[model samples]
Target: MELWERKLKECFGSAVVDKPKAINNEMPGLPRYVSEYLLGFFCEGEITKENLKETNDYIHEHRIDAREKEVFKKDLLLKGSLKLIDKFKVKINLTKKKEDTIQMEIPSLGISDAKVSSDILQSNDRLLIDGLWGMGEIVYNEDNKQIQLEKFKPFQLSEIDLEELIEMREQFSSDQWLNIMVSTVGLNYENYNRRQKLILLSRLIPMVENNIFMMEFGRPGTGKTYAYENISSYSRVISGSQVTEAQLFYNLTTKQDGLLVQYDVLLFDEIDKIKKTGIDEKVKNKLYQYLASGKFDRGEVEKVSECGIMMVGNLPPGGFSEEELLERLLHSSITHSAFLDRLAGVVPGWELESLKDRRKAYTKHYGFAADYFSEIIHKLRKKNYNYILNRISLEGTTIRDADAINKIISGMIKLVYPNGELTDEELKEIVDIAISYRQFVINQNFMINKDPELKRTISYLIYE
Candidate 1:
């Protein structure tokens, strides 16, 4: 164990300072001392400089144990040989307090039991969902917690199995609203867990609600393509630069009639590169109709109404302002046409480049779990999940463009949560995210409109 610890420190260098709680917390789940030791090293040493400094400062301020967590490593190897693995199993006993709140304990750890308020647990599940690897794998655990919370609490509980959960989700309440439901009522998982569920739900809900084509648009590394590529074997993502109408929907040239087949998802990477006449007329017309109605006629054969469409692309650097980003590109191409309307949803991409070290990698567990859920959600979609949103209300919801936006939100929720079981709180949050996205678009468009100064700019005038 000592040897392994030394090796890990050597591996990461000076960033591997002693932080006992993190070391102790991770020790049990790791199989060998080597893994735990390396984890500590990675957590400390490989961390970004800011994180390294922050954690170091935190350890010092808290007077945390600075001694090499080498003893914990030795205990791991020695205990493994003794077949005392049971000793390492952390028994997390959680008792229900108020409705949706919990009191948790693990006597063996000699720590005072703690309580999680209903508000805390009920906070947006996405908050819990993070890009971190292990943290995002807690959805199943959260699902389990839902059942336990209902059984133990002496309060009225909503009967929500995965089915009802789906029903609520189909409401299309709004990203913010759905986030709230998932956060408070939905089981809280880590970010990876949340992302997995979000990816699956995002794809599945649309199929269940409208079976209309959907596209995820954003810059690179946002996992837009990853979702279609890795989540389900049934889905396919192809480069927009290379795909032709025939290859995408129908291959009439082949003996098998070109395998003219509809798919669950047909994701287009680099949609901005799609060739068009006059940046709008011919190109926008073809793509727009196909996206909205799923109909397209090529040279020899025509394929109509066959698959869901997801288009992803990168916005130019400092591309117009946020509001103008999507609008500027669209207006430049075609000027507010049907192509924009056919889009069921648009995932807003974060602007700043995520710190390279802050980025996460796909793990075996995340991949498998996501794949499994994708199957489940796909199967469930066959059951018909759609709702109608006639009315919704939220506090302090004043806005410059309430009428049109509210209608869109309501319509989407109806599409998303068909059973009409969406809660008041869930509705509020979804509206928030939805409104934020719309605001982003509108504001960005305003900036682009004001860019008359760029009318003479070479790049602005150059057609893609």
Candidate 2:
């Protein structure tokens, strides 16, 4: 009976009609707008001239202004349509003409010539973004913007932090602009705020050719898995205990029974739980090498896909002193420095603590559409990693000295940067997290190895 409902029935007939009905009858009721978006998505390419006319009439019946109707239609055509699936949501995109208006002189199968429409293919929010641009755009003028954009190229790297992101957004009011522009590009604003936006941006910015960045943190219930489970159609999560290298690197071709194919993100849950003893060292080494350099060979077809390797793990028990935890980890069978170095970023998971009050978890507004953030991330990956880092570091401290201390601190510094790029201020923050993590590790190690360097320094341990 609604505008989108009529349009959907006209375009897709009983199929979509059943969908909403089924939602009400068998599942939770979807918001009207969300349902309408799904209806538009279902009949995306299948829309015909007759259906369009019906849809136009339905829009008028619903008092949808011609201008607004045009905008929504434009979004539908350009950005594909929004679909709701179990747990996750998907936004598909159609090819778009990047202009304010699109003029078609040729006649379609039935439509007449001289058809003019607005060019609204993708959500402005989901527009192809270079993460470095967001950071540099906030700091320098337009001239420097171009300079930074050109200097950075997408690659495997980490990013800066949430507090600094808030500061940047505060300094320039670009957060509002981002919300406006990016939403028009096809993202939902309800799913993100500046803090989470920055965190997601940092994790995704340097992701480039054959890149793998793993984030394993101590915070247990901050909804890290929730985002991956519900967002972006391009990703999937696999339990570490169940995964095999074949599933990760390649799948089997059922017909010939060889490896099938690879994916964009191979997220391994409980990575710390995998059985390491039985697997051959050769296979382990190969897996490590592939993750580090992004290469593997099978006769003539050298499969080189831009796959991102993400592993999430919780820190050991808190009862052990920081030094004890580190010592226990060191005594473990894991051995591979290159893999450790390739860790582009490390999120402080413990920061995302579970609310002591269970009622806080019941709020409707707590969860966000992960795909929206994922799409934003997909766009940020277009920018250069190093360039973004340099631009951000302009105001922050630079680690000219990457001593063991510096190297340790750099990981935290990278978390606050746009793409592992830090400013002096960002460096200080990074230095703090690094020092904390290092202190934890060092104290634990002292108990295991009796090393003096493991002692926490007055400067390293920040006193409140």
Candidate 3:
């Protein structure tokens, strides 16, 4: 172990368990980026007998694989069960000759078909599985061998102890947590001010909000896409002037899930450049459906997704007001008033407004490693905090305005109070921040639709 690695471990705590290593590409089916982030030390580099001992510790250590993988099963006769996470296409068969069998396919591995018990299929639709995977050599291709199912256990977060989580969190002060949060996304926390922290946090909002639609348009160099691009394997950021419907939603030819289904955070960079003439009407409509219903239909497939959608683009350093941005979006981009109505919030990244920014030689604050932080957020997202919305007075607000407010509030609750415990002042702080973010959406919407009440709601949020 190196000195820097030791310091990183101490500062970040368990958030960065291991350093990044080169990814193993020979392993098919599993997402390599995810494996590298979560299990990089073991999965990276060449396979060796000495390193295989670490793999054998699966017996002693309780940690399990939590990403997609191409499991090359060695023995078809093994009966023991193992846990793993991956996408499997399932089908049912109830032939009297056997109890029952469910067919599963890992298309990425060229495993066209395999069988699992009905128990595995019970929580089938929620593909974010955490269960034991039984391994068997069921079939063989030209070079790669197909794996068989021995057993599986779908993972879920049961009831949590609020006190225990709070006790654990108590070790760090608010400043420490804030620094850790920023550092987790690969930035030095001390380098940013309070406004910059909000900008950085805006990137984490997707993990906090359920299918929240967010956008940040600013001058190109403001690091708008920095966190989204480097922070997590759960996110995918696509940049282009012309985005096709099949590419984003679904592919009709291959029947493959698009970016919406595959990633937790789906970012469309250079959204300002996505011209109306360059986009297909169907792609635009599918985006609308995804925004409106948290899912989209492509022929026979209707994917229920929890993806947080974000749009990013370049804006001038000055002279662009909310009203002007609304007009520009309508004329230059595929997004319309109907589409704009579905956004949960908008971030004003240009507000950071630093002319002479400098990077520190080393990080002063320790934060969660990108992989560890991603998992912490993944779990935090499961918490319920809708009750916090009751704290807000919704008088004279439209339904969309109220819903947007709740979405942002929900984000803050998860970010600040993941343990489901907080003081009234703490709660107010979260709500006030949530309001400030959602107010941008309300004000933007008002500019487009000319909603007077919506415009006033922004003022109310800032004043109240």
Identify the leading candidate in terms of lDDT.
3
Candidate 2 residue-wise lDDT at 399: 30
What C-alpha lDDT, on a 0 to 100 scale, does residue 25 get in candidate 1? 33
Candidate 2 per-residue lDDT over residues 1-464, each given as its tens digit: 43433433443232232322212221123222233333343334344456545544433333223345455434434544311121111122223344312222111111111221122212221112111101100011233221101111111112323333324333223344334322222233335655444444333322322354555445455455543443343455776545454544443331111111334565656654543433345445656666555676443445665666566665665533333332333224332333343454445454445434433432221111222334444444443343332332221211311223343333223323333433455455545544443344334444554555434442532221
How many clashes in each candidate? 35, 45, 10
lDDT (tens digit, per residue) of candidate 1 on 127-230: 12110111110011232332111111111112213454444343333443333322221122234343333442443333333234444455565455644553
lDDT of 1 at 393: 37
TM agreement with the true structure for every prediction: 0.44, 0.46, 0.67
After TM-score superposition, the amount by which residue 200's alpha carbon in candidate 2 deviates from its true location, in angstroms, is 8.0
- Candidate 3 per-residue lDDT over residues 296-366, each given as its tens digit: 89898888888898888777445686656745743333445567668777787767543244344124443
Model 3, TM vs. native: 0.67
How much does candidate 1 score in TM-score? Answer: 0.44
User: How well does candidate 3 score on lDDT at residue 322?
Assistant: 64
Pairs that collide in candidate 3 are 82-132, 82-133, 83-132, 130-155, 131-153, 132-152, 132-153, 134-150, 134-151, 218-315
